[model samples]
Each structure stands twice: as structure tokens, then as C-alpha cells.
Target: MAVAGVSANRLELLTIADAVAREKNIDKEIVVEAIEEAIQKGAKSRYGAHHDIRAKIDIKSGEMALTRHVTVVADDWQPEDELEEFNDSAMVRLTDASKRDPEAFVGKEYIENLPPFEFGRVQTQMARQVVTGKVRDAERANQYEEFKDRVGEIVNGTVKRVEYGNTVVDLGRGEGIMRRNDSIPREVFNIGDRIRTYIYDVRAEAKGPQVMLSRSHPGFMAKLFAQEVPEVYDGVIEIRAAARDAGSRAKMAVLSNDSSIDPVGACVGMRGSRVQAVVAELQGEKIDIIQWNADEPTFIVNALAPAEVSKVVLDEEADRVEVVVPDEQLSLAIGRRGQNVRLASQLTGWQIDIITESQDSERRQREFSERTALFQEALDVDEVIAQLLVTEGFATVEDLAFVEPYEISDIEGFDEDTAEELQARARDFLDRQAAILDAKRVELGVQDEVMAVPGVTGAIAVALGEGGIKTVEDLADLATDEIRGGYEVKNGERTKVPGVLEAFNLAQEEAEMLILQARVAAGWIDASELPQPPEPEYEEELAEGEYDADAVFAAAPEGDEGEVVDDEVPAGDPDQPENA
Candidate 1:
């Protein structure tokens, strides 16, 4: 297109723009706009700089036009701050504009045609540079918009270059980077090698879109299975969870919507052909396809497949599971370096501890013996009766006292009358224990404010008082960690003592609740209000000089200064002198 007297074939200009847009993978409209802008710059150079010039291109016909624009304003109108940049040539007063066009009115735009310009070497080069830069920016924006929503999907690309163990892949229209850590262990890539990677993230950076790819991400395996397994892709089967050691072994939990179709079998395919394809892509990484279970214990058992679990004891509060397997299955359950159990824990979202049946039996027996002894001593019961109580799952005197009479009577070898008598004795013993704790609390001078805090019973008050936390203020000052485990000094070394929570037989949550309650009772915080987290304390550097105690004390407010000053007395008064 010829613009501002420049001799350029309109068809050639449009052809070049179309080719550049296609080559750069940018929208054609952006290229056209860039060309129009370049022409405008050239036009402005030829015409007066004070004139407002613009250029437009016809996409189909490749025709170019340049026009000068002037805004009509009232004769008395003055330039505001925003319009101050425009010179008189860029604006026309209504009276002056009306001389040329009688219909000209204020707030109307006046357009004037400008002659086409001759193309000079500098102008042509400048236009080309502008077109190149604008095309590049358009390409970047297009790539970002295209790939932003494709994160967590798998894409195929060719390795373009490798820098310091980071492989840059050319994804046809865009580029991606796979860091060394994100690749499978021992996996290597060469230039021009075709590879598939998971688009874990795409960031719009200052330079361009940063597409981060990964081969070791658990999602990568899930995506691969989706490509290989029709059932997963169609949603008949769902992959619940995946955990990978990457190139060594991996675990996947799959569930099926149709109970008739086994999720694991569907993922595995007949004779493991489908799974083998995934394994080959992952460089022979072992894949365990286990059926997912709604029940956590059952899921945990499935996660640790090939290892027979005899029993599972769940600690929901801690989100941990203790799995007991046969003695021979112990090694398999733990796997090499505990990889099996580790992956199982990750897959089930719970901490897994494996023990052999024999070990579990021994531990159970030890606990039973300890509980039997405690019941015998605390409840004044014989060894046989204590054993019976322990066998019935009554581990403490409190259990006997608080349990329903029917539950106590239901225990084998215990009649209704015997159960009632035992319950009465248990209650009497607990009453006596409470009285003793009350006396100890009083002797320790435990404050009623501390005792009144929720979760702080007579026993806990006594423990806190013994630990030198005798008042609500002292208790309130403790952190959650400190309340859960008291600070201790051993062998002149200060350390946090464990089992403080266990000493009160309280859970960690309960210990924190008690600390919050104490803080509220002490007026340090409001009820149902969360305390503000303490800010980090920075040490102040003191100036080198003799310390000025008076300057420091004088700034404190009233009682905070530590000595009361009489308002009636003037400083250095002879009759009434100040007391130090």
C-alpha cells in the first residue's frame, strides 16, 4: 500500500504482512495494525509534527489511506490538562472550522486527506522494525492465551536445546522448558528428540510465556493413563490418587463407577498390555494399579498391595494408621527402604506404620499387663478381676466409674450385683482422688482463674502449679507448644519436655484449647476471639554511652514507670522531696 506519497504496491504490502503473521503465528489483524502505525509515523515525519495524523489499511484490497484529524472546539474554550499536549494544528475552534464547513460544530471531528508519501530507506527500515516488534509481541500474547488453560495437560514437543541440564522444547507454535528435577531420574534428552511432557504450569513473564513441563509429576502419569485407557478418558473409571518415586516405582489408586468393571483391570488391560505401554513411556517405571476404597483403612490396605494386612488400627486424631501384617509379609510390606509404605502413606493421605503380627501381639500383651496392674492398684481389685476388666477393654478406674452399669455387667464372669458394687467403688475412689488433687491444688497456691479455664481440671491445675504456672497470666503467656510440652532443664541444658500433653492425658488440640481459654480468662484475649500472632522481636542496638535510666523511666506511662510520683509535688521541691 502507498501512504503519504510513498511508492509501495498495495498488494505486496498486504502479502508481506500476511506471510509475516503466518510465519510468526500471530493474528493477521495485529500485523495490519502494526503496518498502519508504521505508515502513520512516516506520514507524521512528512507532514507537520503539530498535525494529528492516522493511517488505516484495507485487509482484502490492500489499499492504504492517511488522514489528518482535528477536534472542533468552541472559540472561547481553553485547553485542559489532558488537552494541553495537543497543539493548535491538532484542534480547530468552531468559528475557524465554520469558515471551511458551515456545518462544523463544537465536539465534532474534522478529517482531511493527506497525499501519499515517497518511501525512503530510513522510513522503510523503521516500518520493518516496528512490524517485527509488534508481530513478536502478538505472538507472545497468543501463545500465553493458548497455553494458559492447558496446564495439567500432556503435550508433545521436540527438544530444541539443552542448557545446564534444562531441556527447552519447541512446541510448534510455542516453547516449553523441562527442568532437570522435573524429569524422571536418569532420563536424558537430546536435541530434536520428540518428547511428551505434562504442562504443570504456564507463567506470563516479562519476556514471554514460560511453559513448565514435567515428566516426574504424578499428574503426568495420570494423564498418560488417560490417553491409554479409554475407560479413564470417558469417565467410566476415575484415577483417585497417584504417588511416584519416578523411574523406580509408582502407585495409582483407581475407582470404577460401574461395579461390574474392575478399575484396576480396566487400567491394566488384558495381560497388562495397556499398563505396559505406560511403563514403556515412563522408562520401565513400575506401576501398581490398586482399586480405590472409600474406607481409609481399606484404601490403605489396597495401597500396600502384595502385602497381606492382618489388622489395621487407625488413629484418626493423628491421621496415622498402624498396619499389622504377618511376620513373613513384614519385609514386603515395608519394601526396600520403606518405599512401599511411604507411597502407601502418600496415596492414602495418612501416615502408615507397619508392624508384624507377632510384634503387634507382643505390644498388645505389654499394654494389657500394664493396664491390669493399674486397675488392680487403683480400684483395689484382685489380679484376676483386674484381668477380667482389662479383657473387657476397661483400662482405667474412670472407665468403670463412667461406663453404664449394663456394660460392666455384660462383662463375662461379672453379675449385676457385682457390677454395681464395682461401679460404686470406682466412683468412691475417683471422689477420693479428686479431693486429694483439690488439696494439692490449694497447697500449690493454684489461682482460681487458672483452674476455671476450660480443659484445666484439678489434676492439670496441680501440674501447672508444680511447673511454676500458678496464675492465669502465667498460663496465658504460654505458647501452644509450651502448653503441650513443658520446658525443662536437664544437665544444665534447656530442652522441651515431651509428654506434658500425655501427662494430662490430653490431646494436642485440647492442650491448645486450654491455652486459649487461659488467655481469655486472664483478659489477654476476648472469648471466641483469636489472639493476634506475636510479631518477630528485633534486638535494638544501644548507642555507645553511659546508660540513662532517667530517660528510659520518664517516658513510661504512670504505674509502668515503677515508682509513683505525687502530682502536687514539684520536681526538686525542698519540702516534699521525691523518693527513689
Candidate 2:
């Protein structure tokens, strides 16, 4: 396109702008504005750089106008910023301008028409830069608007180039980048090669809007399955959960709202045609399509498929589960480098442990022996009787000590006298153990008030003192995570934080209760203000002459006259799987 003074026809300018707009895929009005800016820049360079030069172009007839404007300002006009010097060429004082023009006032502009001039060598270069910069900005804006809301959708593109393990993709109208970690393992892409990627993120930066693409995102597999399986796209069968190990392996849990359809079979298709399509696109990544069950344990069993599970032990409070399989199936259940169990854990939202049946049996035997030993030492019984008590589900000495006399007497070959004798021995053992732990707590400088908190046991008091929580105030200040354990980021890595009562195996709710009770004991809160838990089912009062260990050896402050609650410690369930 020729300049204003080059005798270029009026319609010729609009034709050039229209062509540029179509080629750049931007609006024609943006092109016209950019050209007007370019002309204004050139006029400034030819006239005075300080003058306020303006340019306008009529889009229809392509009529051009050039004008210079000087605005009247206050006599004491100040520049916009400290470093900006006042320009008299663009601004004139009202008092001075009023002498030349009788009606001149502040903010009034004196306008003059300027004849169009040919562009010089430097002006032409400056105009080119102005127009190019404006057009580039408009293109970036258009690109950002087009792709900003397209994240999580799949898109097709051509590989523009690969630099430093990052693939740059030309997404037709915009460019996207897939970082090394976001690409499938060992996958390669060459320049100009056709590719399909998931739009995972779109970020606006100073340079441009970045369309972050990925082939390894778990959502990519879900989208692939949606495209391959009609039921998934129509929401007849839902993809409940998905986990991927990039190009190596993946697991997907599907659920069918309609009882007539089998979710797994539908995903598998006839002879696995549907899943095969997804697998081929993922570079032959193995896909396990498991039917999801509403019951978590059942779902977890399905998640660890192909390896028959002998048993599943769930610790609901810990969000952990242990799966026992036959010895020969251990390797298959764990997969290569533990990938199978890891993906299962991710898919089920549970921390999974894979164990052989023999290993589980050994662990159970160990726990049995340990409990048998405890009963013998606490009740002064022989191995036969100790084993009998363990076999009957008596774990802690406290349980045997505090249980109703009838519960112990009902055992075979046991009479009232034998039950009474066992009760005496169990209570004596608890009294001795409590005294020992209380002495140790004192030696560790634990305050008596720390033991007075509801739910605090003698052993728990000692544990707290050893963990530097020696006072009720100290315990009151703690968050539940401090007592139940959690993770923290340190040195740019996640590190496990050991809880103060980690060894007690306290549940999250138990930890919260302990802290809240401590807060009341510390005078930080009122006991009445605490959340009241549902009362436990009432049991009949123990026989009048029965030794009450709870009343005698319960930990308490010197002056505390309040009731003492039972141990916060887990009431060891003898039947529980040892490794659980």
C-alpha cells in the first residue's frame, strides 16, 4: 500500500487492510486502527515529535485526514509524572493562548489541518514497526480469546517443532506447548507431524497466552474413551475414576446407572474394540476397565483385578486397606515396580498394601503370640489359659480387668471363684502399670494438670511429656494434625511430620477430642462449650466388691474432682488382621 502523498487511490488503502486482516485472521476494524496509528506515528516524525498529531481513515471510501492539535492548559500546568518534562509544543497555557485567541480556555484544543507528506527513510521504518506491533498485539488477544475457555477439551494440531524435550504444536490458529513431563513416556513427535493433545491449561503471560497441551493427562484417556464409546459420551455409563502411569499403564473405574448395561463390558466393547482404540492412541498403554461398586472395599477388590484377593482388611479411619493374595499372585498384584497396586490406590482413593496370604498368616500368629504373652504376664496365668483368653478375644489387660465378672466367668472350665481371681490379678497389674507411667511422666517434668484432661491416660501423659507437650496449655495449642500426624513441605519436598501421640494409633476424631478437652482444662475454653459426643451404651454396674481399676488408678490432677474417662488408646481388637 502506498503512503498518503504517493497518489494511492482511497479504495486501495481499504483493500490492503482487508487483505491483511483476512490473512492474520483478525477483524478488519483492528487493521484499520493499526494503519491509522502507523500514519499518526509517521506524521509525528515529520512534524514535531512533541506535537499531538492525529490520523483517521474512513473504511468505506478510505478517506484520510491528518491534523495537529495543541491543548490549552492552566498557567501552572504540571507534567503527569515526576520525570516527564512539560511539552509546550503539544500544550499551551490558557493565559498565553487567550492573547492570540480571545475565547481560549483551559482544556480547549487549537486544531490545524496539515498537508500530507511523503514518508522519509526513518519515518517509513518507524511506521512499519508501529503497525507491526499493533497487529501482533491484536493477534495475541485473538489467540487468547479463542483458546482460554477450551481447557480440558481435546484438540488436533501439527507439531511445529521440538526444543529441549518440549513439543511446540501449531493448533491451527494458535500455538501450544507440551512440556517433557506432560508428554507420554518415550514418545516422540517430529516437525509437521499430525498430533492430538489435551488442552490442560491456558496461561496469559507477558509474552503471550500459552496453551499448555498434554498427551499424558488422565483426562486425555477419558476423552479418548468418550470418543470411542458412545455410552460414555451420552453419560449412560460414567467414568467414575481414572488413574494413569502415562504410556505404561492405566486403570479406569466405570459405573452404569442403568442396571441392564454392564459398564465394564460396554467399555471393553466386542472383543475389546473400544478400549483398543484408546490404547493405540496412548502408545499401547494397557488399560484396565473395572466395574465400580458402591461399596469401597468391593470397588478396591475390583481395582486390583487379575490377581484373586484372599481377603481385604480396611482401616476406614486411616483411609488405608490391606489386600491379601496367594503367594504366587504377589508379583502380579504388585505389577512392575509396584505400578498395579499404586494405580489401584489412586483409582480407589485408598492407600493400598499388597501382601501374600502366608505373610498375613505369619503376622496374625505374631499378634496372637504377643497378646498371649501380655495376658500371661498380667493375669499370672499359664500359656494354656493365656492362649484361651486371647482366643476368646481378650486383648489388653484393661479389657480383662474392667469387663463384667460374668463375661470372664462364662468361659468354659471357669467358675465364679476363677473369674474373681482373674479380676483381682488384672486390676493389680493395671494399678502397678499406671503408677509406673505416672512416675515416668513426673520425671519427664509433665505437669499434673496435663493428666487431668478428659481422655488422657497415664501412658498418654508420659507420651506427651516425652514429645515436649508437658502442660495442658501446650496440648491445648495443638492442631489435630499435630497429634494425628500429617505432611509438610520442607526444602521444596514433602516431609512426613511425626505426631506427638503417633504411637498411640489415635484416630483423627480422637485427636481432635483430646485437644479440645485439653483446651477446656487449660481454661482457654469452657467445658460446656465443647461438642458433646453421643453417650455410649450403658452397661450394668460392676459387682459391689469388684476392684474398680478405673476409679482407683485413673490419671488426674492433684485437686481435680471431676470424672475420669477411660483410655483414649485403641481397644485392641484381637480379631483384626495384624498387618492391617
Q: What TM-score should be assigned to candidate 1?
A: 0.70
- Taking every candidate in turn, the Cα RMSD to the unseen true structure, in Å, is 21.4, 10.3
Each model's lDDT comes to 0.81, 0.85
Model 1 lDDT per residue over 1-580, tens place:
3322245788887778788788887878898899888888777767866788998888999888789999998888865787575468888889989999999988899789888878577677777777777888898999999999999999999999999999999998799999999999899989999999999999999999999999999999999999999999999999999999999999998889998987777888877788889999999999887877765666777788767777777776666677878899999999999999998899999888888879978998999999999888777889999999888878778888888899988887888999999988888888989999999998999878777887788888888878878898888787766666667788999986764345655667777777788888889778869545567543354689856676565554323211212222121112211110
Residue 293 displacement in candidate 2 (angstroms): 1.4
TM-score for every candidate vs. truth?
0.70, 0.73
Candidate whose lDDT is highest: 2
Candidate 1 local distance difference test against the native: 0.81
Judge candidate 2 at residue 550 and give its lDDT.
62
In angstroms, how far off is 238's CA in candidate 2? 2.0
* Tens-digit per-residue lDDT, 281-325, candidate 2: 999998888777766666777788766677777776677777788
